[model samples]
Target: MTSNEHELEDERALCRYCKAPVPENEWFGLEVTRPVKMPDGSTSEVDVDFLDAVFCSQEHAALWLAAPIPPTVVPQVTVFPRWTRKLQRMIERGRP
Candidate 1:
C-alpha cells in the first residue's frame, strides 16, 4: 500500500452518520455520555467510546441528530383520448 494510505489507516476517524474517514485535523470530536447507576444507588455520567464516533463537520453532526424527512408521492394524471374525426377534418382542410 501507499505511504499516505498507510498513514490514514493508522490515524483516521469515521463520521458517525456517513461513515467517511476523517483526518486528525478535521476530526470533530463529540463527547457522548450516558447515565449509569453507581454502587450507592446514585446516577452518574459515563462516557461512551465504543465507536469513538466523530463527524467531518458541525453540519454532519446536526444531520446525524435530526430525523430524516420522507419523500412525497405525486399523483399522475393521464391525458384524454384524441378526437379522430376532428383531426381527420383538420388534416383534409390543410389547416394542420
Candidate 2:
C-alpha cells in the first residue's frame, strides 16, 4: 500500500466510554444534531459526527446510552432563550 493509504488505515478513533482505539474501518457510532442557544437568543442545529464520540462496537454504544447523564459543572446562562414549540405550549399551560 502507498504511504498515504497506510496512514489512513492507521487512523483510529477513541471510544467515548471505554477509550479503546477503534480503527477507521471499525468505527461505530451515531450522527446527531445538537441544538445550541446562541448569544442572540437563537438556537442552531449542529451536525455532530461520530468522531466526536465513536465506539468500537454496538455494545459500547448501548452502554453509553444507558448510562446516567452527569450534571454539568460549567455555569452557563441563557437569556431570552429560544424555546421549542412543545416547550412553549407546556409553558402556556403553566406546566414546568
Candidate 3:
C-alpha cells in the first residue's frame, strides 16, 4: 500500500468533513468559531467543524457565506395539445 493509504488506515489522519485522510505534505489546522449576524441583527455563533481552523480557504468560505439564497420558481404544465382537445370531446361522448 502507498503511504497515503497507510495514513488513511491510521484513522488519525482524516479530515473531519470529507473524511479523506489529510496528506502529509499539507499543513492541517483546526477551525475557529465566529459570530454571524442574523437577519434580525442578532448575532449567532457558527462553528466550522471541519478544518477546526478559523476558516477553510478564504475565498471559498467567504463566497459560501455571502452567496444569496435563490428565489423559488414554480413551473406550469400544459395539459392538452389542440389534437387532444378533440380526444377529450370523444371521451365526453362516452367513446372508449
Candidate 4:
C-alpha cells in the first residue's frame, strides 16, 4: 500500500453502528466472525478482513450490540416531500 493511503486509513475509522468518525483517543475496536456457506454447499467460518469498527464510546458499542443506530435528526427540509401534502393538510387544518 502507498504511504498516503496508509496514513489516511490510520486517520479515519468509522463507527460500525453510527457511521461516525471516531476520535483518536476514542478509538475502540471490536472483532467479529460469521459463518458462511460456499457455493459448493459447504459451511465455513469467515473472519472480517479489515478493521470492523472504531466506536466513539463504550455506550455506543453497547447500544450498537443491542440495536442498529438510529438516523440522525433532520432539523430542516429544502424541498417539499410529496409536494408537502402532509404540511398542506396540517396548514389547512390550522394546526402547525
Q: Which one is best on lDDT?
A: 2
C-alpha local distance difference test of each model: 0.63, 0.65, 0.50, 0.65
Clash pairs detected, candidate 3: 30-52, 30-53, 31-52, 31-53, 32-53
Q: Ten-residue segment with the worst summed lDDT in candidate 1?
A: 67-76
How many residue pairs of model 4 clash at the backbone?
Answer: 0
Candidate 3 per-residue lDDT over residues 1-92, each given as its tens digit:
99997666695455543455555556345444445445465654552212242222344445434554232222346676885898799999
Q: What is every candidate's alpha-carbon RMSD to the true fold?
A: 20.0, 12.1, 12.9, 15.6
Which of the numbered candidates is closest to the native, going by highest TM-score?
1
What is the model-wide C-alpha lDDT for candidate 3? 0.50
Q: What tens-digit string does per-residue lDDT give for candidate 2 at 1-96?
A: 999976765666678889877877787775444455555756556522122458989998878877753322323665454566767889999999
lDDT of 4 by residue, 3-82 (tens): 99778767787887788877767667765444444546555454222225568788877777677534322235576687
Clash count list over all predictions: 0, 0, 5, 0
* lDDT of the structure predicted as candidate 4: 0.65
In the range 4-93, model 1's lDDT, one tens digit per residue, is 988877677678878888767876765544444454656555422222358888888777657442222223565544766777779999
Which regions of candidate 3 fall more than 4 Å away from where they truly are? 2-8, 34-96
Cα TM-score per model:
0.44, 0.43, 0.26, 0.43
Q: Compute the lDDT for candidate 1.
A: 0.63
* Reference-based TM-score, model 4: 0.43
TM-score of 1: 0.44
